[model samples]
Target: MLRLESVYLRLKNGSEEVPILENINLDLEDNKFYALTGPNGGGKTSLAKVIMGIYKNDEGRIYLDGKDITDFSITERAKAGISYAFQNPPRFKGLKIKDLLKISADENSLRAILRSVGLCPQDYLDRECDSGLSGGEMKRIELASVLARPSRLVIYDEPEAGVDLWSFENLLQLIRNYHKRGNVTSVVITHHERVLSLADEIILLVDGKIADRGSRDKILPLIQEDARCCWKANCGGNNDEVECY
Candidate 1:
């Protein structure tokens, strides 16, 4: 289980302290899938980073299975069974795909891990993990690495971004399979309705605060209603832009 108690974060914006997250509290149980969604710049990603120790929280505490990890560094957090998949996965210029997979899991498991993400091990194993690979390819490789490692908590940030519709569907199915296994707690930060619908619970963040949180059946309708209003017409009085509330 994971818990956050009165967590808060602030950033220096040209010498002024700006609050990014405010008085946040959450409890995530094991073997459950969660979706965190909100408008862009609402601090959803920031909160994820804070939990992973990419950014330190200014106040409150973070606990993973009853241990306080608020002051833990990024490496320390990973060692404690926390894994994060970035929205834009980084490219390792000289690393081979097979080599990276070997680092996460044994050689015997490499082929199966790649196959889980719908990639042919023979086709990609020798490719360089650099710009030569497409965005979708990189995304799949990153996700495969996450699956290779044994983690208690796994956070995926915008997993569908920049992928084709077919690849996106494949990714969704992979995540669904992972959730079904119930080996790790999953948190997916996404705006895709299909992904949101699969979650056991949905958390809506807005303006650095949780606007709503409940089961998928409870919160999805409200989000759909809000999306309809935003896209149907310029409800916010601007002719060119749709306001996502």
Candidate 2:
């Protein structure tokens, strides 16, 4: 459903140019769930932004349903049936949840959107999106926005970040249900093992490139094996480990 051909992104800092993505070539089929996991600074999020048109590519092309969209604006991409949820959601001061929902799904459809996110319509509709809400609440609000848009391609950048255990599980179920509904392609960027297990394919990004990409059997074992060495007290692995999966 989506294709990225020889995509490249570079940031210009005075005379220096830092390449964030180098020659990225990927094809995403319709109605599939793709999970991208990698160490920090591996360009996973950068590639997501590139797909969403939040960052312009310095080389190559991006095509949505066979049409070149490499130079499309973010708003244009959204209009073209693409939705994105950021790692750190933005707070719109003085904006009530109902207003945002009405804007995305139309005033007549707000209740349905809230229900999709497991939220009570009446209780949340009048609430302002601000510091008063908990992290998990904000995450759910962002998710509701995505559901309201009903895009063909939804790129969630670490949807599990702020969510509590119960909410995280709920999010997983919601995503699974969305996938089963058909015609929607999802690209989830997460490092959680449980989340990765839900993917049809796990793409491991390393140093701005795809180092490993395959089914769970092909990739999970490698990470698990490597974790044997680098696991620490906080991450639940031994500190003296070497070549950990």
Query: What C-alpha lDDT values do all the predictions have?
Result: 0.90, 0.84
Model 1: lDDT to the true structure: 0.90
lDDT by residue (1-245, candidate 1, tens digit) is 89999999999889899999999999999999999999887898899999999989999999999999988999999999999988888999999999988977899999899998889999999999999999989999999998788888999999998788977898888877777777689999999999899899999998799899999999999998887766433445775675454
> What C-alpha lDDT, on a 0 to 100 scale, does residue 209 get in candidate 2?
83
User: Which pairs, if any, clash in model 1?
Assistant: none
Range of the 10 consecutive residues with the lowest summed lDDT in candidate 1? 230-239
Q: C-alpha displacement of 165 in model 2, angstroms?
A: 0.5
Model 1 alpha-carbon drift over 4 Å, by segment = 231-245
Q: RMSD of each candidate?
A: 3.2, 4.4
Measured against the true structure, the TM-scores of the candidates, in listed sequence, are: 0.89, 0.87
Candidate 2 local lDDT, residue 220 = 93
Per-residue alpha-carbon lDDT of candidate 2 for residues 4-41, written as tens digits (9 for 90 to 100):
88888898769999988888888889988989998777
